[model samples]
Target: MMTVDYRTLFADVHRRPGSYGLDGSYGQAVAFIMGCDAGNAWGLLVGFPEWLAMKAGGGANLVWSALVLRIAFPGPTVVTAAETLDQQHDEHAVGALFGLLDEFLADRKGSRGAAAIVSSYLDWQRLRREQNS
Candidate 1:
C-alpha cells in the first residue's frame, strides 16, 4: 500500500490563507501538527465526525460542515482527504488531537514500522482479541 503523510498534507492545506475557519495560535498549531506523526509522518485524515466530537462544540466547524453537506466527494479517499483539508483548528482541539493520534499511530506502527516488509501476526492476534473482547 502507498503511504501518505497526513501531517505534510494538512500543513499544505493550512498554507492557503483565508481558506479556513481555524481558531488558535497559527504558529503553535503548525508546531504541534509538524511534530505529530500519523504512523509514517505528521498528519492524517481521521473521520470528520471523530474530529468534531473530539474538538468542535456547537458550530466550530460549521463552514466545512456546510460544504461537506452540500458537496459530493469523488470517493472515500477524496472524502477523507477533503476532511483533512477542510479541518479547522481549535487550540484545545489540536492538543487533544495529538494525544489521540499518538496512541493510534503507535499501535499501527509497532514493530512493522521498525522494518519495512515486516509483519507481526502475533501482534495482530493480540489486537484482534482486544477488539473482540
Candidate 2:
C-alpha cells in the first residue's frame, strides 16, 4: 500500500478552499473535516470487533463488514463546497485548526487513510450547506 502524508493532504485542502466552500480559510475547514473523520473512524474501529465476531460463522461477516466499511468511507475523502464565502474575524483559530488537521493527516496510509481525509471534507461540506440553508 502507498503511504499518505496528511500534512501534505492538509496543505492541499488548505490550498483548495474553494472546493469545500467559497471561503478562503482552509485551516478552519480542514480542522472541521479532520474532526469529522476522526469521529467516523472511531465509530468504525469500535464496531470492528462485533463485526468480526458475527462473521466468524462463515467469513460472511468479514465480507459484510468490508462492504459496509467501504460505503461508510470513500476515496479522496476531501471536502467539497457547493457555494462561495467571505473572510473570518479570527485567523488564529483557523491556523490552529489547520495545524491539527495537518498532524492527523500526516500518519495515515492506504484507502482508509484516504477515506478519512475525504470523509472529513464531505462532513464539512454538509455542514456548510445546512448552515447556509
The alpha-carbon RMSD values of the candidates against the true structure, listed in the order shown, are 12.7, 16.1
* Model 1 ranges off by over 4 Å: 7-90, 112-133
The best candidate in terms of lDDT: 2
TM-score of each: 0.25, 0.32
lDDT per residue (tens digit) for residues 45-129 in model 2? 3322233223231122243223222222235541122122224423333454455334334423434464554455456556656
Question: lDDT tens string, model 1, 1-133?
Answer: 9865654445444454235444444344444344443453422323333233223222223432322322223233323222334344233334444444444345445553422211343344456569889
Worst 10 residues of 1 by lDDT: 51-60
Instruction: Evaluate model 2: give its lDDT.
Output: 0.42
Minimum summed lDDT over a 10-residue window in model 2 is located at 78-87
lDDT of each: 0.38, 0.42
Model 2 regions lying over 4 Å from their true place:
1-4, 25-40, 43-88, 104-133
